[model samples]
Target: PAAPANSGPLTRPQPVSLGMNAPAGPPTWFVCGAAGAGLGPADSYDVVVRIAHPESVYDLDLYGGTTDPDEAAAILAEALVGDLADPHPGSDSRRSTTVLAQLLGPFKAVHGRFPSVPELRQLLDGAAGPLAALRKALTATGHESLLRELDARERQMGHPGDVGAVLADRIALLDRPAFAGFFDTSGQSRPFSLKALDHPVRVRIDLPERGHADASRILARLVLAQFTASVTVRDDRSLFACLLLDDATGVVTPEAVRAVQRLRSANAGVALTLRTLDDVPRPLRGPLLGATGCRMAFSGLTPWDGQDFAEVWGKEWTEARDVTDRQIIAETPAGKAFTVVRRVITGKAPTARAVTVRQVERERWSASELAHGVPAGHAVLSLTTVKGEHAPPLLVDLRGGPRV
Candidate 1:
């Protein structure tokens, strides 16, 4: 059946706790790489994963390598199982283990199959017997009812598939309550269903290149998943933030930008940086550039790149002013000399705005002649002092500066 409008966006079953939970804020950064280590060491920032909303925020450290989907799935399963183990020590490890095995099992059994939450739940439910036995063993050791709640959850949720569905549904529900409730005409909303909330301010993705296509797919999926999570819980007043930084070229695919467009439509902010502008594929350039509000140019050396930058900044601005190559003509008593100057001279020459370039020189008497110097901020002064051996510094009073 065609899904209803309120059915919300279709999503792959994501680990409930693989996301972040915080009030939404401006999207400041988006970083993409093979591992979280690429962003920096773990000590750099606080890391948290939302078990209930895997799409929201995740620890990139867990999925670092570029492995096949099956291998990746297996890795994710192991990571999740490991996390659950500490909280439910007495729970049946077999079920959790089996659930992953089935999803990532060998010989095409696990191939082409991305288990939804419901599928995972069913498998886990089947392993309940083993879990129950383990629980009983723990109870005897003085941890009674250690897994009773989990067992009860299994029963209340019914089939393993249903449990998975509920978890997925709840995660989604949390991001889109109104839309989620629209489909439930019974006048009573499901208690644990997903609800829409404000989009998160930041998201981090791990993209490892096991295969070109597969890695691209993973990046694409991460982008879509984040956008889906954002829209389902966006607030009107908030600007969603997406920061994508990739160390590897071609790690982000066209699908990634398309997914970002979805977020942009929801009024989200996005910033994506690659090794170079050329790293952005030609096909995806338009939308990617359109989504960005600002562009920053660092030290670019390539001739083609220099031309590309000129094209991007437009010839009108570059030609309308006499600042090409930052050259300036200074009239000296000896003759007219052309000097290469470092200044940002804007507008047309005679009637244009002029500013002086700040320069730092070593203090001759300082240190064992080992005193070093560095260039600093900008300053503006009269050009008549250009050839003067000694020039007085000009100071403007900010209290009475010209008002625009």
Candidate 2:
């Protein structure tokens, strides 16, 4: 049966009959939106989790208090490495990856807890006194490779401490006075892990982007990375998982692009919102666009951004009609008289008209039309199903209500 035509936003809850009906219930909506966005009324949700930022001063665990060392390290590395440049041989990225990978696990095992941002900053500084004790511990454990990575850092620690100093500088930002009590490692603030996605539970993390823009971006990327990782290893593949990032600026990286590609196979999807293609890195712009099954360009999209969508949507075949009017020569006198009479009667030229039709290929939506032709409260969208079915670009009026 169809629902009531004038149903209000508030509706009656599902009734539970005595062992007769089993409602599947609502699925969890894990939202990651900007801080101060006031996503919704607190009473509407079962749980409301807030993050620690400058304005909203609270202690939120950065590491998520995971017992697994590898998971902890991955999250930490995602925060430090902004774009995650290719780790070529002898490159800063490679050295940085090596140092971080070797340091995180051992430090966790030895200290029985993850290191805080300030402690991590000190550990990466080659000149720091703690490195000596860490070295002795690594030596005793026969971690020759880890020791070698540290030695390499020392070698590269010329006037500027190559990768270590670069990474340490990044860690130092969080350690500043403004971020005190945040990113805590003392296990005081209950860490929220993406692993919670395994069950049906609602979670929302509000990022503080106003004053702490860089930290917000770092946290956004970290959450995205963790979400992808969690979805990949879900116990039940039948349950569909989804993540929506309200603002995805500076969150798209090489790893993230790859992760987006694998999401569909895992019965999962991610929706990212960006102001423009410029928000994505130059090289990853194409890959990220390709990875997403659904692409939407709202009104005010620049031609440059529209061009990418136009290319992705490609071209379609359509019929083209051509019409031509030829003046009659009037070879016979009777025909000339009839033509003149008809022309006089109609008050126009007497001519024969010809029509031709042919198949032609054209863009679904041209760049100019997408950029300027899209009206306010409208967007161009294209979609591809997990089974490889496709829907070409469509101009949709967002102001319209959902169709029944």
Q: What are the RMSD figures for all models against the true structure? A: 21.4, 6.5
Q: lDDT tens digits, residues 1-404, model 1?
A: 01111111111111111134213432333343444334443332333222223342332222222124344443333323222223343223234333344333321132233333333333344456544554455455554343444355446445633323322322232223222222221223221111122333223344434333333333433333443343534456353444344442443344345555566455443334444556555655555544344432322223333333333333221112233243344578333321222223433222234554544433222221111211112111111111223322222222245421
Cα lDDT computed for each candidate against the true fold: 0.34, 0.68
Q: Can you write out model 2's per-residue Cα lDDT over 8-65, one digit (the tens) per residue?
A: 1111121112012322333434567676655555455445555654444234456644
lDDT of 1 at 322: 31
Mark the 10 consecutive residues where model 1 has the least summed lDDT.
7-16
Model 1 RMSD to the real structure? 21.4
Off by over 4 Å in 2: 1-28, 45-47, 53-61, 64-74, 84-94, 137-146, 159-161, 333-349, 402-404
Residue 42 error, candidate 2, Å: 3.4
Query: What TM-score, computed on C-alpha atoms, does each candidate reach?
Result: 0.34, 0.82
